[model samples]
Target chain A: MIDTIAKLNGIIQILALVLILIRAFLVVRDLTKSVTGVFFMFAIFTHLSADMYYLIHIAMNKGYYPPFSAMDLAALGTYLLFGAAAHSLFPERTGERSETIVSVCAALFAAANVFLWGYYSGAWFQDIFSGITFIYLLVTSSQAVYRTGALKRDKWYILGSIWLTFVAGQVCVPILQNAGAVLAANAVEWLNYSLMFGTFLWLAAKVILCARRTEKDQALALSFGLMCWSLCTLYMCAEPFYQLALFGETFQLLLMWFIIERRVKTA
Target chain B: MIYSENIFICIVIPLLLSLLFIRREGFRFVLGLVIGMLVCLLSAYISAFTGTVSEMGHEQVAVYISPVVEEIMKILPVLFVLFIFDPPSDRVFLFAVAVGVGFATFENCCYLLSVGSQSITYMLIRGLAVGVMHIVSILFATIGLMQMREFKAMSLPAAFGAVIVSITYHALYNLLVSEPGITSVIGYLLPGVTAVLLFLVNLRLRIRVKT
Candidate 1:
């Protein structure tokens, strides 16, 4: 049974990779006019790099740890693009000053990424860059929520993707290093794989939802996506922190979405 | 001098007083207090479970654990308010602010106790930063809930996204200021920026309501 589970886990990982590739291809194909689509193309590239890194690491001996990894740069670039895309896609719901501030912040992030890659020395620079990026994400996401009075449906997939990626990158990697219990470690690895697969599906769903929607529908879809994603986090991770981070927000997103949908539908 | 006793006086005492002073809607207020405290405890527990102990420093705690824990805890009272009271957006926002005030006052008290007889400048700064950050985060999370109500599918992601953003903001502030430098100055400025954002958002909501 254990062997079978492990085998199933391996199969799931492979399937997830394939799905990610397909989604990437689809995203690229759709990148005709929309800057957001182009941003997603960058995201896909980052996904591919991250997925390939895992595949290679598993296939070969573990070697090299630092800011120099190609995958690391890809991840960093993905975040920068994602931030920029989010700002561009969602115009300021308030005023010109707010818009200017957000644009400048995004611009600064872009400039920082360039400088970090080009001029900055020391591994700590990478850490600082990442830290700043995290903050940037936080501020922009809050602004998006505050302005729109609803979470974007696409953001659900993004949050899931980020949460899963972080779990794989930070938590699973560290635990795998320790190797105290093989069964538990394998279970976590499988969970990570499942999350990745789910994220891809969620992303695809988001695109479809986005394409089909009126403004009201878009809001509704985003809310539903958030609720489902949150519930998934609760069920899949079975960790309190995950619940706090994912589930709590999920409920809030659901509420906002419902309100907007009601208003729109009535109108 | 007040800093040393702030936790008890600010957090515990007010909480206790609310239990006694609140008259007309006694049960509701009590329920809110209970829910708020539970959320805090749960957040602390979740943080520990994730191995994100603050004492272990940033590497072990901030990155992997704190975001998930703190964000979730911040949302609990909002959930409770929705469940128990079924408040409209205005009432929901007020309840959120109340919960934030409770959480912030307590947190400030704890900080004051730890730091001891600090200068008035330090107290004011800490009060504004930490106190308001707590309120802003809760408000943002609540805004997410309000948004979710309007645009259903956006609910979970918006709420989670808000929490994640707030946690990241809090963590970055902590990380940057742990050392004294240009980064620290930026860190100090963050809460001020965050406070201004909160005020603007609140104003927007008020205008929206009036219109």
Candidate 2:
């Protein structure tokens, strides 16, 4: 069963990687149109390289490697790049207090991870860096939704809640597994999948609706990108969750395409 | 078995002397080169200590730890310049490239000493591949930070994000090249491909900004 799932994961990763490459080319071809496009391209490029690394590892049949590797670092890079994309896309209209609140939350998240996971090595380093970027992304996307005035904003808040719950579930799975709570870990793993699937559905609906609207809303597209980013971070931590992460990546690439397509249309 | 310090001293003296004649951005460039070499040495010490403490094998250390240590060390000077000197934003790229060049040059020297420079083709490949990899990785951070600075959205996350991008790229290269066969070939070519892509993007972005 596990072998079948692993093979499925590899197949889907290759599929997603191809999609990402095509999207990257499209973004780069039209990149001169907007500064935000450049950052988005970088974000996509990181995902491409990271996914390529994993695929190559599997192809090489190199088994039982270190727990932390290029994929972890690349995951961190992907989040950071998305955070950059958000920063470049949205204007910095939020006050310093909001920034501070986000920073505090990020710190608390890091502290919690350390308390749970232990400050060991590369994983810990990635966790702290991921923590900061994660919080920044959450705040920036929420802020984009809040300020865009196009979406209902309440739906975004709800989406945010679901995504956070999924992340919390992901963060707990390893702890439970490590503590020999195998059944509990499996249960949470299922719960995480449901939450992520629902989140993707909600986001897809949001993207389609926004596209149907009369006005072109950049923030809505960017928020969708950022939300998908939140979903994509955990594949490094959980092996079973790889398929769902690829689903999230598909959503992200489609979002990038939407943005580029919109830009080209407007141009 | 290679005496890295001797190589450093032999190269640094002339570079330092040349610095006396250079001025303005040229001065900063030479200074950046010198600092890059210095940081390369420091990174060796730090990675050595980290490897011992972590108890990982040499290959593991090279793939997992060295990139993080070396990238951070390489970027330290650029970060210092941004924070303290606050040189013109455009000049940051020069400092970044200089640091990467210096670090790569020193690293190549060490490589030659460790394994005699028997094959010119291999040396040329290393020079182009590893050298461009270093430059392109640091440029990722430099360009990201510059964009954030331009947008007035430069935050701690953005800065760290830029550095993390560099670290991850370096790690990916190290991981790929650490093995033999097709993976190593991909690793060697990755840098040049990325450099070309980034150059075009940077050029277009600059033109967009100016116009």
Best by lDDT: 2
Question: What are the candidates' interface root-mean-square deviations?
Answer: 12.2, 2.8
Which tens-of-lDDT digit does each residue in B17-132 have in candidate 1? 66766654554545455455545546655666656333454444543355446656777768776767777777777667666666665555555666774599878867777677
Residue-by-residue lDDT tens digits, candidate 2, A1-267: 756766676567557656755555544545535556656666666666677667666776766555546676666667666766665555656564644544454345434544333332346655665565565665555455444554454654564465467558867787899999999998997887777666666666666666666345543444544453445444333555665575566665666556555765565
**Candidate 2 residues B107-169, lDDT tens each?**
888989999899999998899899999999999888877766665667675577577778778
Question: What TM-score, to 2 decimals, does candidate 2 have?
Answer: 0.80
lDDT (Cα, 0-100) at B48 in candidate 1: 63
Give the share of true interchain contacts found in each model.
0.00, 0.31
Clash statistics: count for each candidate = 46, 0
Residue runs of model 2 more than 4 Å from their true location after superposition: A1-35, A61-68, A91-129, A150-195, A218-245, A264-267, B206-211
Model 1 docking grade: incorrect
